[model samples]
Target: MRRLPLLLLPLALAACNGGTGTPVTIDVKSDDGDNGSFRMENGTVSIKGDGFQGNFRVPQIKMKADDVDLDGVKLYPKSEIAGFHITGGDKPGNGKDGGKDGSKGGGKDDGKVRIDFTSPASLAAVQNWFRDGFTKKGFTFASRGDGFAGTTSDGGTFTLDLSADGGQKVKGRMEMTGS
Candidate 1:
């Protein structure tokens, strides 16, 4: 009898997890270590820090459960919105400014990343999202595929790239000339 019940346990446990689990929204929070916070809920992410606060949302398309913490970039600070989020930069890193000659120093390069995520929005829609957002914020741009190549309000040269099929998930990146 004991052996019978033990063998049955595996079947029962597998039954409980047989199919794709229900979709759920997830909330993640991080500390700025100075009274700021970074929060990511489902497809959107946000961040806030000493002198800056930003809210971003990407398309919420179908995807298997996975984490996009972006190697713990520590940019998302504080806020809430739906749709898209892009946050990742640096406070300090292996790229330090003053180290031994061969030792790693602060990178002279401004940080950047390629953001590829599924969006219910099409390639055109995703492109429009950035274009509208940027223009409203006083960033003038020359339009491209699904994003913009232009300049920020403060005159920073800006570039955004979007890659996808007609109505597919978007693979994109946003960059400024410098920091």
Candidate 2:
């Protein structure tokens, strides 16, 4: 029976490829039966399935934290916004395609943004910084098994997740929705 699952694995994975021909690689390691990880690297996108966390890195897309408005929330000191996507307002560029809409435009806050970033700081520090910033802004923040989530008084929501990068840095992604 165990071998049946192993045989079916390829089929399951093939469905994930989406026929992009971009080449997808997945690595899964489990300590027990339930506690394990699933990681996939496909071109510029990397995902960790255990926690539903991932980030996309594209060379053509250029951005900074200042370029997008996250209300009054602040990012960790020296953190870099590696990729972003904004819609619903006059925001610049798409996080998935780098302004593929052919508009070098700017707009008002539509209260929706997805940001992927890297921080030289440790994972714990990054979480603390966001928790502090959001709470002060009146957002209720709580820790999940993998990361943190919060919501604003007016219906805004924020999510954060960071994983160690096998070195001194951490890579993470954050998303906010609602104005």
Candidate 3:
């Protein structure tokens, strides 16, 4: 009887630390439609060990309209694992034309945007959110395959896609380039 308990103790311990339930991490590279001529670089997202938390970092981004350059934009997972809270500001620079006599004037800009959920269950929610948010601001979603390609109120066209590999994880890709 003593030996049986000893054997079961190790088995129970092994079950507790099976190491098979370890959280999986994914890296996503995304683009925020700003200017097609100018390439936005240093976009990366990392999910934490628990999967419920995450971080998004964009080291650099260039856009023509606001003449915006983003350095190290960070996002954190929010109420919903699929949602994120972004916090950061823009870098200094004009678009293709540097702030010059004929070039677009440049200035400082700062704000935060809430990235809503975009998973299988939240697909409709995502679409509605985008439609309401962008359309109210003067944008529309043009037809695309499992996504939408459209123009912003500011005259910037972009494509957004939501993807799921039939698993727990869902991914979204947004690409915006000058029209």
Candidate 4:
């Protein structure tokens, strides 16, 4: 019974595009000769065939920054959220850190959530903001190839990467996985 929600998380996260209250049918066919249809309507998804059948309400993600929570993770000031999504742990492998050598060695937690945003602040400023905030929250930070990684006292993990988006805007992504 517990696995049901975990299994549904991928489907919900994949199909969610902000419901429009209109019904739509999607036929899915794979090279393995397995096929099925997914019907989405009014914030609900129904599946048929392929041995995966059920109806689940797609979880709504809040676009407002104040309503978003990534444990104690904080978004950069004046950031405008562009996208958000989550993946359950049961899906296998680790977070994006799963290596190219097929080694699953990072973020062994219950789930992972990511938020994409842009801010009209300098890249250095954004990095400093997160560094200060995470440090104050008892997270130890380490530099990564692309950005930085932090681990909380409770074993949760988070990563932040920011790059200039031309002019004064900076684009970034924050991913958290654990507890």
Error of 1 at 83 (Å): 18
> Could you estimate the TM-score for every candidate?
0.36, 0.49, 0.34, 0.57
List model 4 lDDT by residue over 1-179, tens digit each: 22343354475566455624334444434323455555555677776655557887884433554545455656766677776655443322344655335657464455567777887777777778777777787788887754688787677788878788886888888888774
Candidate 3, poorest ten consecutive residues by summed lDDT? 31-40
Candidate 1 displacement at residue 18 in angstroms: 23
Q: Write the per-residue lDDT of candidate 2 for residues 1-179, one digit (tens) a residue.
A: 11322433343344342322222233333222222222223335444444354455432223444544456776676767665544333233523333446655343244456677777877777777777777777877788755688777676787777787756578877888764
Off by over 4 Å in 3: 1-121, 165-169
Model 1 is weakest, by summed lDDT over 10 consecutive residues, at: 72-81
Question: In candidate 3, what are the lDDT values of residues 1-179, reduced to their tens digit?
Answer: 11222232232223232222211121221123111111112343333221233344333222221111112111112212233233323233433443334546364333232233334444555455455555566676675766567776655556667655355434555555433
Q: Write the per-residue lDDT of candidate 1 for residues 1-179, one digit (tens) a residue.
A: 11322332332233232222222221222222332334334434344444445554433333221332222211122211122332333333334553334555455434343333344456776666665666567766797665668766765566666667456555555455433
Task: Highest lDDT: give the candidate number.
Answer: 4
* Candidate 1 local Cα displacement, residue 63, angstroms: 15
Model 2: runs farther than 4 Å from truth? 1-62, 66-69, 87-111
Q: Which pairs clash inside model 3?
A: 33-176, 35-178, 36-177, 36-178, 69-91
The per-model lDDT (C-alpha) reads 0.42, 0.54, 0.36, 0.62
C-alpha RMSD of candidate 4: 8.7
| Residue 66 Cα positional deviation in candidate 1, in Å, after optimal superposition | 16
Sorting all predicted structures by TM-score, with the top scorer first, yields 4, 2, 1, 3
